[model samples]
Target: MHAPALALGALFSATAAIAHLACIAIGAPAYRVMGAGERMARAAQAGRLQPALVTLAVAAMLSAWAGYAVSGAGVVGPWPFTRPALVLITVLYLARGLAFALLKPLFPGNSATFWWISSGLCLLIGLVHLYGLLAAP
Candidate 1:
């Protein structure tokens, strides 16, 4: 059980690293080239990349659930901060999805603000997970 927790922690960390590389490294350059309108259109296009993004998002949610499970399994006692942080992270991700769905027009042109906001939310969520892993008893 402890090993699973540790492994899940490592999984979370690795996923975060990959996400940063994909979004910051590959995605940033791609966005700069395409511009926001094209980027939004590309995102809207049903293809390989969008499914991959959805998979990544689902994996992240599952990883968080695993961490919560591990914590509950007595490998780590309940940490005061972990649950709320996780909830906030979930909310941010949900909000991003909702923004994409409901506010599509807001995303398509010169919308660096959307990118920045989403990126910041992802970073905060990653940080919170790392903190939970480190602080877990």
Candidate 2:
């Protein structure tokens, strides 16, 4: 199995998931630092559920993506539709990274730093996943 690249991709996704969960636990400051916008931070500070709920949903999806990567790597038992799932995940990350420039207007609340860092990370992870999948026997 093509283990290395997929393993790295899994690691990246899992780390991001953990970070998202941490933002929820850490509250307003975390939200702001993560470029989640002042509105989200205010909602978090106000004890509204929206920020936490949205963060949780994102974290859960990231975790699932990590699991798919691990499954593709043969690091665990095969998950259902592992190959297809990996392809989709790869495409998702790549698309997100590549489209970030055009999508800036759509996400005006997020900081430029956030966009740069996130886009770079997504591109890296997407490339790793692509390499792993392509190298698979």
Best by TM-score: 2
| Candidate 2 structure quality by residue, lDDT tens digits, 1-137 | 49999999999999999999999999999999998888899999999999999999999999999999999988899999999999999999999889998988887888898899889999999999999999999
Q: Give candidate 2's whole-model lDDT.
A: 0.94
lDDT of each: 0.50, 0.94
All candidates: TM-score: 0.34, 0.97
How high is the lDDT of residue 128 in model 2? 94
On residues 35-82, what C-alpha lDDT tens digit does candidate 1 reach at each position?
Answer: 444553456353437634653575566566545544533466754565
> How many residue pairs clash (N, CA or C atoms closer than 3 angstroms) in each of the candidate models, in the order given?
0, 0
Distance from true location, Cα of 36 in model 2, Å = 1.3
